[model samples]
Target chain A: MDIFRRNNVTVAGNPQGPTVVLAHGFGCDQNMWRLTVPALADAYRLVLFDYVGCGRSDLTAFSEERYASLEGYARDVVEVCEALDLRDATFVGHSVSSMVGVLAAETAPERIGSLVMVAPSPRYVDDEGYHGGFSAQDIDELLASLDSNYLGWSAAMAPVIMGHPDRPELGEELKNSFCATDPDMARVFARTTFLSDTRDDLGRVKVPTLVLECVQDVIAPREVGAFVHQAIPGSSLVTLDTTGHCPHLSAPEATNEAIRDFLAGLPR
Target chain B: MIHTDQQPEPYESQNEGAPDIQSHRDSTPDAAFAALLEDSAEELYEAAPCGYLSTLMDGTIAKINATLLDWLGLERDAVLGRMRFADLLTVGGKLYHETHFAPLLRMQGDISGIAMELRCANGDRMPVLVSSVVKYGESGEPLLIRTTLFDARDRRAYEEELLRGRKAAEEARRQAEADRARLQDALTVLQKSLLPDTLPTIPGVETAAHYHIASPDRLGGDFYDVFPLDGERFAFFLGDVCGKGPQAAAVTSLTRYTLRAAALHDADPASALATLNTVLHDRYTGSGDPRYCTAIFGILTPGASPGRLTIQLASGGHPPAVVLRADGTAAFLPTPGGLLVGVLPDAHFATAETVLTPGDTLLLYTDGLTEARTGADRTSLYGDEALLAFAADHAGKSTVDVIGALTDLLASFGDGLDDDTALLALGVPPLTAQP
Candidate 1:
């Protein structure tokens, strides 16, 4: 299989610079990195891709069993890295993708060298004394929320959102469009994201890691950020002065600066 | 008359002098109507039928109309510049706002008619349809968001009803499919009970048989079986009962067992068929739903000479059996003037006799094969002549080889062959000299 085509992988920025793969979390696709892409494109080789069942990735390749867990998404990352034959490339992941990057790094240690987790949460549902900011019932509510919004994600609204008369250029740039996914596939990804617990895998991280959290994110609170930081040995944590879960989109400058500093500090 | 004329002149002079009274009467109502229209713009915004709110770029409520505040049961002091737009939504709606709604609005600049629920101050959920547009600054940067909410209580209730109806229909369809699958499995097991699992091997003869079903859901009416009558003689029968499904299958089961029992009593092929005919006619003739079958019963006996067998067969309105020779010759053992079994109290059965030496075979089959439609238009019958010619081509082959070739031919017919078919080939081993 052509992993690049299957994953809808796109390469940009300085061709000779060290590679950095940007992975979006659940809900949105690769377009989530639009603001951060411009910040790192000058000196870093950037790789962006939509996971299977999201964005322009081939929907036929999506298997419910294969993608029922986080490992299937990690396999996509590993395959993309192998397809590009990258070694020691940094992986920048947002939200649920942060844990996906960890799995991919462990599976193919040579492919991904360092990690940048943006608003990362190892688990969404709280357990024991750990505060993941949500309960099992809350995750069920999130799934219900996803179900209620299925009408908005339907094809009837696609043309209205894509063909904005004021922004005609958007139609050309976003061919498969943004944040639109098959509702069934989105449900699987939602269940996998909100129900998964990856905290046990945090202590296994061997790469240079940087965890960036929003100062006041409802999805990933400060306690979760500190937990991930302390779990991964020698990992640095930076709290961006942002209020939402997506600091890269909400506070692009701070997120990019923290990412760039982490990349520069890594061994050549 | 003179006095009335004088009064009219005086009244006319008074009316001409009072024109200002008419203008005063017209201007009074117009002034009152104008006063009602004054200072109503702010009142319209606060008292509009639908809720309206404006938020900063990050969803901070910068402004809200009294109509929306009334719906939310929140005061202006508590809402304005204090709570974000998400704070007013239920938990599910808040997640929806963060994941799909906000991202789509950011990319498209406007999103409309999204179904969502708002949590009122009293903890009651209100279903509402919301539309939002970003108010951009002069530099094309987003400055704030303008939103409108319409009550969708009636629409939501109707949609819920439709959802329930659709879910019920889907469940019914799933249950029907599962029931069909189970029924087919039961029919297959019952059908197997009416036929032999494997043909019994004769002392010096090679035997092969094949049965094809037209539909998996309906039980086929065709059955065939081979069993040893005694130590030296073997009895075999192939037949098709009229009609299909469970009733015909029951008759097929009865016909098979009757033939076996009759053969044990009297090994004559004609006598066994006569017994079956008697049983079927006695059992079904009294019922309104009468059942009948066309069958070929045959007996194989060791001949006086070694490596030779004597075959006697009787047909009851069945197609003639074919005989193939090692000399590349084939012909039908025609048993004409036979009547369909169970149709009358006494039915005439046509009997034919033949001897099978080394390198000779006998074939028995029902009409499903010869009656199969063929050709491009599917208007032509395969017929007995075609079967004779096909058997001639495989005259010198073993029973297994001939049956295997015929199976392929049946498969090639595809949909053109839409009836249950049974084929049985019994052949003798060809003589070979020592190498």
Candidate 2:
């Protein structure tokens, strides 16, 4: 199989500079990095891709049994790295992808050298002593909400979502195509994202890690951010003063500056 | 009543133009009513039927209409400048708004017809459809956001009903497929029971048999068996019952057991077939659904001389058996005068006898082989002449080789071979020199 085409991998930016792979989280595809790409393109070699079952990636390659856990997504990441023969590259993941990057790093230690977790959370449901800011019932309600919005992702809404006749410069492939996904695949992805627990894997991070959290993210609260920081002994944490879960889109300037500084500090 | 009250006014003012009546009404109660009909734009904004709101780029509500405030049961003071649009949604709706709704709106200038639920003041959920647009400033920068909400209670309930109906239909289709698979499995097990798992090894002879079924869904009526009749003799039979399905299968099962029992009582081939004929005619002749079958029964007895065997066989409305000689020649042992068994009280069974020298074989089969269709148009039958020629081609070969070649010939017919076929071959092994 052509791994690059299967994952819809895209390579951009300075070819001679260090590589940085941008991995988007659930509910969106590689387009989530649209705003952040421009800020880092001048100094880094950027790799962006949509996981299987998301964006324009091949839907036929998606297997429910394989993707039911986080390992399947990590395998996609590792394969992309091997396809390009990347070495010592930095992996930047958002939301649930932060844990996926950690797993990829563990599987192929040579391909990914450092990590940058954006709005990261190892767990979303609350435990007895730890507060991840959600109850088990809340995740179920989220799945229900995904079911209710099935019409938005259906073919009836495709023409409206893909129609951008006024913006002819956006090209045929990129015209207004933003978070359109198959409803059934999205349901599987949603279940995998909200139900997974990767808190135990945080202690094994052996690379240079940067944990970027938003100031008022309801999905990943400040307490969860602190737990992630303390779990990784030498990891650094930076909190962006934003209101939503996506700091890169909400506060792009601060998010870019933090990422650039972390990359510069890494060993050559 | 109003028409009757004003009926005489137009006629009384015919001398004047229509404008004179309009001017005269300026001084009457009609003028006051017209004044009341015209309202300012402010009243329309506050009293529209649907909910409306405008927010900043970051979702801070800057303005809200009275209709939306009434739906939320909140005062204007409590909402404006104090809440974002995400605050009014339930937890699921809030997550949806943050993940899918917000990203989509930012990418496209506007988004419409999104279904969601809002939390009212008393904790009741209200289903609504929302549409939003981003207003751009003079510098092409995004400014405030404008939104409208429509109550979708009735529509949501109907959609739920459709989803339920679709689920039920899918479940029923799955159940039907499972039932068909289970029934096919049962039919396969029952079909296996009608034949021997393996033929017994005769002391001084070699035997090979093959049975072919045209369709797995329907049980075929073809059957064959080879078993010992006594210490010095072996009995074999091959047949096809008339028609197909359960009734034919019942007849096939009965015929096999009756022939076996009669052959044990008397090793003569003709007597064994006559007893089977009597049993079948007595059991089925008087019934309205009379049944019958075509069969060839035979016995093999070792001759007094070494490297030789005696064969005695009888046929009841069955095709002739072929004999292949050691000198590479083949001929049919015809039994032409036989009547179909179970058709009459006293049926005439034709009898034939032959000697099998070393390297000689006897082949018996059902009509499914000779009646198979051939040619490009599939209109020609593979008759006795072609089978005799085929046997001639494989003369002097062992029983296994001859049977294997015939099995290949049957397979070559493909869809043209529609009926069940059974083949049984018995041969005396070729003599080998002493070491």
iRMSD, all candidates: 2.3, 1.7
Worst 10 residues of 1 chain B by lDDT: B1-10
Off by over 4 Å in 1: A1-19, A36-53, A56-68, A75-89, A152-177, B1-41, B302-307, B429-435
Docking class of 2: acceptable
User: Clashes in model 2: which pairs?
Assistant: none
Q: Give the per-residue lDDT of model 2 (tens digit) for B1-435.
A: 001111222223444444644555667677666454433344445677778888887788988888888888889888899998988988888877877787777767677888888889988888889998877765656676778898888988887777677558768888988988997888787778778899999867888988889888888898888899878889999888998888888888899999999999986877888888898888888788899988899988999987689999999989999999878899999999998888888889999999998889999988889999999889999999999999999988888989999999999998889999999999987775212
Native contacts, share recovered per candidate: 0.41, 0.52
How many clashing pairs in candidate 2? 0
Residue range B108-216, candidate 1, lDDT tens digits: 7777887888899998989889998876755667767778999988988887776568658769999998998898889989999998999998878889999999998
- The segments of candidate 2 whose C-alpha lies over 4 angstroms from its true place after superposition are A1-19, A34-63, A75-88, A151-185, A248-261, B1-49, B136-141, B197-212, B227-235, B242-291, B300-312, B319-333, B337-346, B353-414, B417-435
